[model samples]
Target: MKKISKVFFITLFLVVIAVALGVAFPEKFETITGNIKSFVATSFGWYYMLLLSALVILAIFFAVSPYGRIRLGKDHERPDFSTASWVAMLFSAGMGIGLVFYGAAEPLFHYMSNAPLAEEGSNKAFKQGLSYAYFHWGLHVWAMYGVTALSLAFFQFRKDEPGLISSTLKPLFGDKMNGPLGVLIDVLAVFATVFGVATSLGFGAVQINGGLSHLFGFDVGFTSQFIIISIVTILFLISAWSGLSKGIKYLSNANMVLAVILLIVVLVVGPTLLILNMFTETFGLYFQHIIQMSFRTAPLEGDNRGWLDSWTIFYWAWWISWAPFVGMFIARISRGRTIRQFITGVLILPTLIVSIWFAAFGTTAGNVQNSGVDLTQYATELVLFNMFDQLPLSIVLSIVAILLIGSFFITSADSATFVLGMQSTNGSLEPPNTVKVVWGIAQSAVALILLYVGGLAAIQNTIIIAALPFSFVMILMVIALFRALNKEIR
Candidate 1:
């Protein structure tokens, strides 16, 4: 692993140098960026929708299989955290900045450009808008996390291989993983996670800064970003140092409470009737056209193709990029649950909650747009402050928004810190606290630097590029996980 890490860093340095040089020459960089985007757009295209749908089906099958009876840890032992605590961590880490950013924007985006299944400017817009948000937040996204957590719980906690991604692949590679092959997989997972979580950090910083600026009437700048990062780093470091039982357990529970309060407040104060109606219709649409929407790929020549690429493909790629962190975090919390229990906890319950959030929040935002309570002009700005102005109760809503963003950011950072600690210390079930603090601080520093450099878009693009290698690694992980499950059953 150390050797692989060295090689990876060296290669990364070279790539950074190349990119730096490219940046120095604007025309050259623009050409390169365009070519890369074109390739991704064309190759990934509509097929991603079908591919993601297949993955969701596979996860459902695994959830129901006999091997799902296998439990993590000792058969008789109780779990470390309460059910609520466990669920909160799973939801927070899995959802992260996504829920905050997409909560308003996704529905509004879809409302403007209706789904392929809906007529242009039809009444179906509101339903289809929420439907798309739920789809992105639902079973498929959580399933990615489920597979990762299940692999770790069974192999690391139960079977006693090290609690790292490479060890999870041991069922497929056996002794081969002890050498170069294993190190390579671990490197990919780590690098992917760093980039992915960093992207979340970037987004969280920007949004939080935006909210604070609006709430306090202060100017938004890198100073706000730096302050948020500093606070996040300190909080997560403290959490990491306290270890899972004391730190993570409490944080997750607090996060859930805050989330529920925000949700309930929005439900009561916003367009309650409109939200309920839209939610019911959206749920119906989601289930009614599940097959078609899930697998839809408009003809290459049609207008629907753009919408599919922007939303569906973007979502799949985002989930894939986030799989490592989410998987490892779930694995950490799922030590005493059966595979079926793990699946239900990681996939089913979280999806249901996320869908509800989108139903309530997204629908309210859409109603505001449709009813002209606000022009929805700010949604286009991609800044949370501007976006908040579109709603009626901007002040109260902004507070809830800040809490939601801060808690989720902390949730993700703390979990990543714990996972990185475990991975670095030879994958011990309870790695040393020092390791966690180190990684937590490192993540914050990276986030701060990314924020200072070019804000959210730069960080996101960097993460997407870093995630390219891990996309293949996750596919390999699925293969290895199934092989392990098959061997266990046999």
Candidate 2:
């Protein structure tokens, strides 16, 4: 309590007021949030697309430019963690549950229902679906994160500033960052992180409940999801209490292992040849059209424009909202690396790995649907488990997925509490246990409240709305980073 900064109290108060409003007027809450979300997506859709495209370009330039030689810390400093452990922790913290949640469902949606640019249920739609999944989960998503994390690491580790998002802007704002403006910036960051992570937690709970209901005789309702969230909340709070090193590290490693196992199993047990073929083809397709997809606004096509709003714009906002939490966590683990090394590791490596994961899952799901199975009939949360029903060792796959989602849930929530604690406690590397525990509970409560209000739709709407303000903060960070780097070189 003593070590906690005013940001904690202010953000917590805001969160409490939000939860109260959500509970008191659930329908109104849903309607207002949905309307705001639509407006942002419609009006600023081009902005989201352009900003993300610029970030991707900037990330590549940083990796290849002379500035690449700059180290995040002292030139003599070696990395704090092994490359393997560092990748595991960052990947787990960055996009663990999302990969599992949407691995099959998203591609399936595009292939069978609504694709970005192709006719539904056509061969072109099939190829375009996997390619679009790669587009959403690949380079652009990571660039948003890589750029944010790079700014934080360079400022905090090399420039010896406190580990806060606002600190990165000190070059542009100077001592003004220490005043009320800085507090406002940090509050927006904390607010975005809370909702961003809470939405992921909500997805985890829903999918876990979906898996359980598919396996056993359980109901897939708010009641089951409530229990799932409660149990995982307890598990993650315990991990949060154990501090950063022991709990998050081990859980992250477990998440990677489980994820790999599931990926391999799906590849082997499902359409192995098709998965391989699709991976090769989609890999080429994604790279070939990467620029077009990056800047795509679908201005002339009304249907394509709507698709862009629902999927591409929504995902851009989602990654932006998640940038603060994931960026900070990546920076904490990525000490003492050169700017080139950091950008390559963050942008390229993960992009390739996620491409492979989606190829295997998406190809397999598409194959199942092509064989006369109606996967589109099922809800999104249940689609993955239902797809497993067509594969050999279905029970085994479902069990592994459930366990994997649970582990990812704990890792993500635990890491978020740590990040939230850091943001709110004046960027303490090791914030107080009381602060972490409170944040742990607050995020879980937010997940539960959003679930009660309108399920996944409510969560998505809130994320898009929350991300709009912080998106401007990210622009300032990029300018500040370039300013500081120029000064260092001179």
Candidate 3:
């Protein structure tokens, strides 16, 4: 483990140096990274749908198998959080700011552009809009997170392996993972998670800053972004240092309550009929076309292919990028759950919540757009803040929005801090609190730097790149997890 750790960190330090040099000498690095991203985009774009379908199939298999009965913790140990609180923590950490930022904008963007399933000049745009929103927020995305969590929880709590990515692979590699290979895996997981969470923090910070700027009429700039990151980092560090029992459990409960209240307000105060109709139709479309839509990779034969690449492929990659951090966090919280329960709770519940959000928020935005409410102007001018303006009781809506974003960001930050601390401490569940604090501060610094460099897009691109290695690692992990489960169950 010591040798592995040294090699992994040395490699990471080299990569960091390279990234720094690339930033300093953009003329060279830009060309290199651009080419790499383009290659990844094209290669992965070809089979994005197929990959997603396979993921869903795996999810279904895991949910129903006897292996699913295997719980995470010792036989006598009980879960720490109630089911409701557990689900809430999972949702808040998993969804982060994407639910808020994309809830309205994503549907509208698809409505104007038309999704793959929609006919040109068809009035079925709203249906397609909601469908695509759910597509982005639905099962496959959450399954990626579920796989990681289940792997970690099962290995760490059940097998007494350290709670790290490498330990999850032990069933495959056995003691081979115990030396340099294991350390390399753990380091890669940590690096991927840090970058992923930093990306979320960057997006959350920008959106929160934009929302505040709109409410208070302040100028939006890097300063506000930095301040938001700093404050959130501090709060999350405090929570993380306080440990999961007190800090994370309480914050997660509050987050869910706030989220539920916000959704109820939207349902009652917004366009009730439109929201209901859209929710039903969208869910119906999702179910009806589940198989077809899951595997619809647009052939590279026309201009329409660009749309699929931009949206669907990008979403898959984004989910992949987020898997390590979200997966690790879910694993940490799901110690006493069966595989079936874990998958259902993490994948299904989050999908339901995200679908409802899109239905309520997206339908309201769609109605406003079609009804000549001038929301398009706000959407175009100030995309983040405009969604709030369209809601009934705009002031209250803004407050909810702020709370939701803040809560989600803090939850993610806290989870990532805990995960990173565990990784650094050789997979100790009760890792040193000081290590957690340090990682929390490091994540904040990375977020602030990324914000200053090129804002959200830059952070996103970096995260996507960082995810490349971990994506392959995850495929191995899925195989290993199933093998371990089968061995244990039989």
Candidate 4:
């Protein structure tokens, strides 16, 4: 009985146009997007850093202030899912394949190649590298998602508005949200979600191919990545057809179990003492330097500035790009919780889990490098598996990692399809299966096109570009959210 709205056609048209351009003129598409990406990073890098820091502050204030008492829905409405399931689902969707893709790779990259401040390959670099990884994947990123989700949940559940991004701004804009401006806002959200999720799907496909190549000596290239995406697309489509409770919920729970098993294995076999020490020290370091790191945009021309643009700026943009999809999905699962409960769970707990995860995998990879093995020599996708090859039960560890990545990939793609369907169908709770299927295929097609055009560079370039306009949209959301909350409590 559900009907697709105009937003569906408009967004789909935009996506088709983009995919066609990429397919027909791959080089030109890559060059143009890369130029724009560079301009954004160079020109507005400070804006991103400042905005993300402010959002982190706002998130903390909402959690601890009296506003914390406000429930997302009516006071008597209880959460539909239990605490554990809620946490599992959000964590799986929020950081999923990125954690596995970068767990071992990022920290090692910093120590050997970049290291924000420290000299490459030094003891200081080794220690500082893990701290940088923590910074990139920590509270600042979550604050973006937290603020977006809070606004959506507040308006949609609390104020009985349509579950659309523009709906959150109704207080300031009034019925104008019912017109073209609202359509533009919704269209932007859908566009950002499509690109953001497609980029992650590309990562999943590339990493899966890397794992297969590392294990079975399969060739690594676009062709292999194509096959991987093809197989996974079918799997996630089947899961999508199964609906949220049956497909996504089960997959999310299974992801946590598999991820934990992999973590324990790495901790037991790789470098337990170093991991424990590194985690304790890096946890303190990350909090201690959190303020400085939040606003650290290197102005002077050098490697530090390049590192900031490449890693920090890119991550901020990537998180913003994902805000629409992850935020709405979180809001959908997060009714009946207090503002404090939602913020704490969304911002704090996952940060801790990921910090530990990075500590275990990163420190092990670093230790292996220190022991005379250069993990940097391997491709980013192959780094985790190669790092495992240096440890005990290497084959078992590699197999488990690939499985975990596969499950996380499926969970993320499945969740994105549901979110996209909801966004396109006027915020319906149960979007039609046909709409979901169209989105599933569309997401995969974007991933494939991006891979075909410029691989990882193209993905990062498109993410930075797609996220910029939405960053402004998020600012409006925060202003609208605060206005609504103040009026309610008054």
Go through the candidates in order and give each one's C-alpha lDDT. Answer: 0.71, 0.93, 0.76, 0.92
Candidate 1 off by > 4 Å: 1-37, 113-121, 379-394, 452-454
Task: Give the per-residue lDDT of model 3 (tens digit) for 136-173.
Answer: 88988987788777888888888888777888888789
**Could you estimate the TM-score for every candidate?**
0.89, 0.99, 0.93, 0.99
Best model per lDDT: 2
| TM-score winner between candidates 2 and 3 | 2
Model 1: colliding residue pairs: none
Query: What local lDDT score does residue 175 receive in model 1, on the 0 to 100 scale?
Result: 90
* Local accuracy of candidate 1 as per-residue lDDT tens digits, 1-490: 2212332343245435544553465455445544574467557655556556767777787778897787787778667767888888788788867787778777776776565566744667767888878887887787766776777777877777777888877767789987878767776676666667777887887778767766786667888788888888887787777877877777788888888887887788778888888787888787787787776667657657767766776677667777777888788787888877778777778877888888887777666666655535553324344545665677777887788788788878988877776666567667676656756766676666555555654554455456566766666777887887777788
Error of 2 at 485 (Å): 0.6
Better of 1 and 3 by lDDT: 3
For candidate 2, what's the RMSD?
1.1
Backbone clash count for every predicted candidate, in the order shown: 0, 0, 0, 0
lDDT of 2 by residue, 1-490 (tens): 2378889999999999999999999999999999999999998999999999999999999999988999999989989888888899999998989999999999989999878788999988988999999999999999999999999999999998988999999999899999899999999999999999999999999999989989997998899988999999899989988877899999999998999999999988889999999999988999999988988888784657778888999999999999999999999989899999999999977998999999999998999999999999998889999999999999999999999999999999999999999999998889888999899999999999999999999999999999999999999999999999998888
lDDT for predicted candidate 3 compared with the true structure: 0.76
